[model samples]
Target: MTFTYTVSPKDWLGIAPIVVLVVMALVLMLVDLVLPHAGERSKHTGPANFTVLPAVGLLGVLGAMAAAVTLFFVDHPTSVFNNMLGADAGTLYADLIILAAGGLGILLSPAYLKRLKLVHQGEYYALLLLSMTGMLLMAGALSFLIVFVGLEMFSLALYILCSFIDKRQTSQESGMKYFLLSSFASAFLLYGIALIYAATGHTSFVDVQKFVVAQAHGHAPILLLVGLGLLTVGFAFKVSAVPFQAWTPDVYQGAPAPVTAFMSIGTKVAALLAFMRVFGFALSSVQSSWMPVVWAIAVLTVILGNLMALGQSNVKRLLAYSSIAHGGYLLIGVVVSGAAQQNHIGASAVLFYLTCYLFMNIGAFGVVSLLERIDNTGSDLSDLRGLWYRRPLLAGLLAFFLLSLAGFPPMAGFAAKYYLFYAALVGGHPELLIIGVVASVLGIYYYLRFIATMFMEGREGSHASSTHAAFERIPATPRPTRAPTGSLTRAASSTRGATAVAEKPASTKIAASPLPATAEIEPTHELEGWSWVALGIAALGTLVTGVILPFWLPQLQQAAQSLLK
Candidate 1:
């Protein structure tokens, strides 16, 4: 017997974003090969360096965004490729979020790579776009097979990107750790999918939902329950909830800052949306079985994430913990969405909160990226002391982002939290509201501490002394010297007015210049034009979302409705 499959033009349209990204990534690789290296040509030449790669990648991302926007407005929710994927408002929204984050990450990368002398721009942009494609695939996946493929696709790219900073041993360690742990999680997820298929004879979400509904009001099979438990564990690891969160801080601190910023927002958006789809819709009939477990995890994540962040002196590690806490907040929306009564409200809240989070989180990390040194040093709290006195604009922007993350008034974070707590109450889970409130209160202390360190604290002499002490510890290279000076040398020195000019090698000229005091260190001097553009976009996004939130609520509601359908 022979089998045949046919694809429609509309199917092509449904996947336009992925197609564009993949093609552009290939084109970029080819372009990189043809372009001359920086040493081979003059700096003024357009292709002399990798500068054009980022611009091309950014254009690709914008094209994908346009396609996603068109699909979203067309409002045609359809299952394509034999139900392997689905296109709807929720998927489109997730795609847009991922693309925006990817674009900002690309914008933030050119300066960071150049400053650190990690100039593999072609590979960097290609991997970024490819990983984004995988994220979009995961968001739209309708079957376990597609989910596994998308998960592995992005995970592999991220593992490489994590270790891209070849000079840092910590970067290599981070890649190894993520590879090992994430592979273990993927195995568990796959096994769970196998068990689910064995028990229900289905892999598609729609089929699973049907089977679950039919089994409602009866005792669920032990195999099915076990599969669900394993699936939950796998996803919990991906989201960095509590005990599974051990890898987050180390990886975030070691990886390049642009990579961290991208992963922090993009991975969460994709994984959380998948979690909602699988648990909130597919397995929602068995809510009574899983609700308590997820509830405990959510509470623990919020408390532990906030508590751990309080003692962190490294900005990257602190933000990693902050990401974990935000995951807990997102879980509240997930829990409420699973409730049969007010699912739309909870679902809409999740989408809106993610939208708000993308701006503030990226903005915060952009500042950290600027402050980082080429050798992977800096980013310590002491490095930020008296920041306002040095760079007022960056200091003020960081303050704004920190305030938003702490859920201050007139920010999108506050609006998002209000919607989430409201959904919890309406869904009859008032306890979630109480826990979220307390967690947010505890979170304020750490966020404010960072701001206070930058503005209220005075520059201490210890920092300068420590820096100078470190500088003095370096062993100076010995240079060849002439024999003891004779009367002729003395006569020549006298002829030169007793002052001899030393002729040093060209390479040492820059190093021999007077070093600034540690208290006056200005890391932002390394920032390039593209980095500032990214910062501006992130700040504008933060302000716009907060100011126009009321006008955006109804659209969020519609997106939520489409997602549930």
Candidate 2:
């Protein structure tokens, strides 16, 4: 007997998102090379003089997003290179979220880099495109080999992006730590793939699924279970869950804010989407084995991520822990999808929550980045004190994003969490719902602390501003001259005298000042046009999408139905 193999155009079309991203990445690289010193010279000057690299990179990311949306309408999932990549609506949506996050990262980078005085403008934008491309590929890959390839691509780009600030030891330390741990995790993941291939003589997810189902009662089942466990550990590290999450806070603190913002969402989406696809479609027959494991992981991750975040005075660490907590919440959707046997409603919940997560998480980080001093440090919560008094619009947006993250009612985060729990309940997982609710309650403390600080606290002492090395080091712009020591001491003494008697009463009556009237606001010399615009866009997009999710859920459900098919 003879066997025939066939491939079709749909297979080629399936890879369009990756193709779009790669092509745009090349375009950004070429632009970087071709742009004359005219743009480079402006780097030393004010924000108005900065180049259009940010805009160009964003256009590329948007183009990729558009292509991904178009791919959703193509109505077929296709596997290419002998089933190495699987492109479907799920992959398309995941790539869209990654691309959108990358675009925002590009927008935020210039201001961040400008502040740090580290200007390799071209390469920063290029690396973001490249990293986004890897994430897109990872989202679509159907075979273990392809998944590994895509994972490394994304990881490598991120390694470089993390260490982009050559001047900062913190950035270098973060890059090295991520690279070492990630390499170790990838080895386990690849070993698991090798073991699976050995048992079934196939690395494609579809083939692996068939093989597992066929040998459900045999020794192959044991081997497959071991491999799956190893795979789970690998992804756990990437998404920073529980014990595997030790690296997240350090990495977030060390890397530039924009890079951290981008990595937090983009990496999690890619990794978790693959986690769901692997277990949901491939190893689902043995769901009983992994379900309990993921269940335990979910509960622990939620509780630990939130509980640990409660004492955080460092803003980046707080967000990092929050990201881990949200990872657990997203995992609830993952588990629901895994356990559900009927419609793809559970998978839809994962998609909706991830989509909402990208916006809200990135928006909050973008606000933190905006408040950071130029050298990409200074992520302390104290920096955000009185933010409402200085920039009420930005502060209000940040508050909204935080509340959404805490899963408060009526916001998109609430809707996403509601669907996630509802999907779990529909699938008969009440324990998961209880854990989620409890975790959410634990999340309240740290989130509210920042909110309270912004509204209630006075601005930090003027002495605090001088501690920012990035700000003090900006050579072209002169710093405000300080008063002589004798005068300063007298002023301090006078203020202390005035406050001593009133301190208790003053604290109770202080209302958060509305944003200073625009005309009355002090002129901040170092504000970069592109950076501020990026922050604005991120904040605005988050609010708009979060508000419209109720309207979008129907279409999202339609997309979800396709995944179940």
Best by lDDT: 1
Clashing pairs in 1: none
Where does candidate 1 stray beyond 4 Å? 1-4, 38-48, 75-77, 216-218, 341-343, 462-527
- Residue 500 in candidate 2, Cα distance off native in Å: 30
- TM-scores of the candidates are 0.88, 0.85
> Which ten contiguous residues of candidate 2 have the minimum total lDDT?
495-504
- Worst lDDT run of 10 residues, candidate 1, spans 498-507
Q: Write the per-residue lDDT of candidate 1 for residues 231-322, one digit (tens) a residue.
A: 88778887888778988998998899999999999888878878888888888888888888888888999899999999998889989999
Q: Could you give candidate 2's per-residue lDDT for residues 482-504 as a string of tens digits?
A: 54545334334432121111111
CA-lDDT, candidates in order: 0.79, 0.74
Give the clashing residue pairs of candidate 2, or none: 115-374
Q: What is residue 441's positional error in candidate 1, in angstroms?
A: 0.4
Residue 40 error for model 1, in Å? Answer: 8.4
